[model samples]
Target: YSGSFLYAIIDWSFGQKCNRHRIRTWNAEQRLICDLLDNYQVRWGRPVRNTSEGVEVRFGLQLIHISDLDEKNQVLITNQWQIYEWEDEALKWNPAHYDNLKDIRLPIKRIWQPDVTLYNYADTRLEEKRDVLAIVYHNGTVLWKPMSIFKSTCQIDIRRFPYDRQNCSMKFGTWTYDQSKVDLKFYRDIEKFDLNSYVKSNEWSIIGNRASRFTEKYDCCPEVYVDLKFFISLERRGGFYNYILILPCVLLSCLTCILFWLPPESPSKLVLGMNIFTSFFVLLLLLYKNMPSNAEHIPRIGAYYCLNMGMIATSTFLCTIVVHIYFRGSGPMPVVFRKVFLEWLATLFFMVPHTNTPEHHESYSLIPPNKAVCGGDKFEKFELLKERFKSLGDKHLRTTNNDPNDENIELTIEHECGQSIEDPLS
Candidate 1:
């Protein structure tokens, strides 16, 4: 055999003590046999393929080799495909027909990556397929299958499946098929750890049963999925607090605004204004007490109420000013003060952007007459009485003229032409 290489199909078996490789070739071919016996060593306690009664399952391949059984570098298979091949026959390849053979590579399956999210709980490994939560197996392997389940648990009671009913229906059954199922009897000794329930122990109680089911034939993994209800409660925390605080504040502020409708003529309007101011102050105090003091900005509810009170207070102050100027003097108020108090204030309230309150009204009162306007008429009446008094005095001094009608008398009390008395008419 010149320029020929001989290749043999090697079946390396260990249980029956066999050695078939020759150490020396006459043509000086030295095959290196570096402890070849160790490669096929078999332990007495190791499981072997055999056939018996109850031991048949125990002896026959309970676990298939995931790939080529290289314990140091293990690989898992997910898709079915060819994994072995022999060399193809061609005219130039006759001398080394069996020397090189082609090995088929299959798609790897069930490869797990360590999930850091579950590090605080029991050790967990996740296997994902097509971006879905396929399996979260316990972090170990016995023989070839994952040893996710203990040997004691039975009757798994899943509180919630990984998928909702709609998705579950689309996928499989009442329970979502995305998660792996393991034997229930293998989980009796273990307890599941919940991160949220554990941290919030004072608020929530720990719940749900932790069990196992057959993911494939012998693999079992943890199934973790929470419903939408759990997440919704977490998202509404701020909204709930805001609603509780703002509802009452809005109602009271509206009531305070209504005080502006009280008639300016009524005595009660002043009391109502004072009362509203007190109530506003009290509410402001309450807000400070209940809310966090570190917030430099005001709460939304407080801002709204403050704005309402401001408009109402401005309206009340203007009414009081109008009443004061009306009664303070006998005539109309000075034009400057009237313009400042009426026109400008009216613009501030009625013409401003926030003048949309439903029941606000403009108030005006009339000024009283001045005493100087009627002074001359009062003086003329006084002068007529004085003339009667003087005539009575002269009656005692001289004989009175017996004339009931003195129209013919030429006598008159006359002063010099240039002289004048203060005319009563004036």
Candidate 2:
């Protein structure tokens, strides 16, 4: 009787396997795969075994598209690869008798999926519900593939600006389950996050990527939550900024240097300087509008602009001083002033003196009657006059035998009109 009972148990197991095969073949013939969905209870609360060893939900990502990278809102959109551990009791069968079937397609609503969410999501719409492709094996392992659009928050640091690189991340895990029940694992060996596979972006380029998994322990809950994070490194495509913003600003900066070469007496010098300064101020305002208001750490480009504006302001101040000095007293230039500015600074800066009118030149002509000096060559004539003044000063000292500070000796080189002598060459 015991032998009979053992044989009966073996026969019953074999009969069950045969029945399962028959049912699978019938479903495939009738185009009734949906009926197989009714065979098991898929809406279980937990898909993992109740033990110390938590469920390992393998996760990965493949970038399909980059819809937008909103700087103002600080958000980005991409296709995320969704995966999880599913209960095998709901869907499992032998492949040999079911026409060697290894996979099946089912409406995603028919299976139980983890309630995962992007904690940094910026959109109001919920994740889409779509069909899932399931690959089953003899060992009762199910691989489910479901694709969805993820609009996640990305903290942008534009301090480096046009030449800046950015690192953005996407975090995924069960919203409710603790690490003790369900854990996330990065399938780094089997999956790859390829930058080349992504749709090219106009404003940014993919540089590199990384993946990691960890658990966060909350103060309120004793159970820690598992997290899977993926990082994508990107570099800004700076061609736009180079041509539109930076190029114009740089050209304006170069134009400012021209002001230093302009003649101090010309009204156009001041007008041109003022116009360049105004343009710089406008560019500064435009930069501020596009950048964050945080004033703690200024960008390198911003510092460049500030320095440019400062130089222009310094030039304006120096121009004012030049105008005042040019229109000052009509008397001859002081010996010390002429020696330091006209002889030293003017030569160092390659500044040429403006030529005086014929009437003014005739009054102080130092050249011989037979030699005709080049017109408007005031710098050369000024040197000759400087030497003549020194000689006259010495002769006066020997004749008067008076102190060098005596007003009469100092005023010895008076004009024919009895006025103080003026440096006509300047």
Candidate 3:
């Protein structure tokens, strides 16, 4: 018990001494912050200990969101944060001298950053995050993150169209410096995209991604240059196209098929065909608006619409010919037409040749134009039928004594085809 009491007293004394030391360090840190601005150098140059060896800037990208992808212009817009880390000997300091201050946030202009820029940029403005701050650690390790929106060029292939997937590449490299002066490395040795903070797009989704780094020597310079290429595969969200475009296209195709089933002699059949054709043309125009006109391969959907349109046009022309043949009494029916349409097609369609015979027909005016359409010899039969109708009307007036209300004396026309036209006045 005596030994334990003595140990407790020693521990209390050490704790009080440590508390006083911490208070002294706190004052030192506050005093150091007052001189932080004065020590910061805005015009600092690139820090390299050996002039021959380059300062290696390890960098990576954190993709936040894909705003839009324009197929016509072949441009992709994205929002991302650029992560860069490198050691600067000129920016180093002793942390113990300033109360173990580990890091400080300073305007990026006070230090040197790698001139890494998007190589495949479509938009000219690449350096948009200039006024950002970098976190400077006491050991001279600087960590900088600058957020920027990039518009990069991508080769667009829309042969699959609404269901298509695209692969876009973003290449980052130092613009003016060679590999010897400004070597690039992946931040933290990680190669893939940092999509931990990704916001998904409504029209497209990221399916896959690839990252690679390589150095190349070009003809313009003898020295080699380093670049990091990141590729993202995007797949279209087809639900919108299916409902807005594909569904309507399919329904129009079905209607085009039905146009052939409409009666050949009906004028409305041609009108309906024209309507379908117009609707299909409108859909084609809408599709062209979204796709590039200079595509190499024709899309499957485009070919389908074109073929359907041709079918619609053919149906319209056939309907017009059939209508004209039914009304034209002078032109003799062609033998091929009589054999194919009147005989073969009629049998195939389950139609009887003289199905409109007067025995089954009601009125004298129920003219089966099919016979006249078949041969002009039936004109005399029609003329005789008209004379008989003229005589029947006069005979009916004499029998009824002009009494329309007399039900006993019914007015009727007895045609040569053995059919009667009964009057409603009876």
Report lDDT per candidate. 0.28, 0.60, 0.70
Give per-model TM-scores.
0.27, 0.67, 0.73
- How well is each residue in 1-426 modelled by candidate 1, as lDDT tens digits? 432222111222222233335433311111111122233233221122321211111000011111111111111111111111111111011112223321211111222211111111111343322222222111111111221211111111111211101010000011322222111111112222213212332221223323222233113535532111100011112343344445556666666655654434234556777777767777667655644444334455566557767866775666565344323433333566445533564355442211211111010001111121112122222233234334645433323345321211111111100001111111
Ranking by TM-score: 3, 2, 1
True lDDT of residue 157, candidate 3: 83
| Predicted model with the maximum lDDT | 3
> RMSD in angstroms, all models?
25.7, 12.5, 14.0
Worst 10 residues of 2 by lDDT: 415-424
Report backbone clashes per prediction. Answer: 12, 0, 0
Residue 54, model 3: Cα distance from true site in angstroms: 1.4
Model 2: per-residue Cα lDDT over 1-426, one tens digit each: 998798667545433323545564565522334344555444445544454655666666667777777665667887755554444545665566466665665444445556666777889784653455565544446666677788888887777987888688887778888977766776544334645457788888888777777789878788889877777888889998897679988799778767755644335667887898888778777777766675445567877888888877776666566555544533565677666665566566555543433333333434542232212222332444445545654443433434342322123222111110111121
| Error in Å for residue 172 of model 3 | 0.4
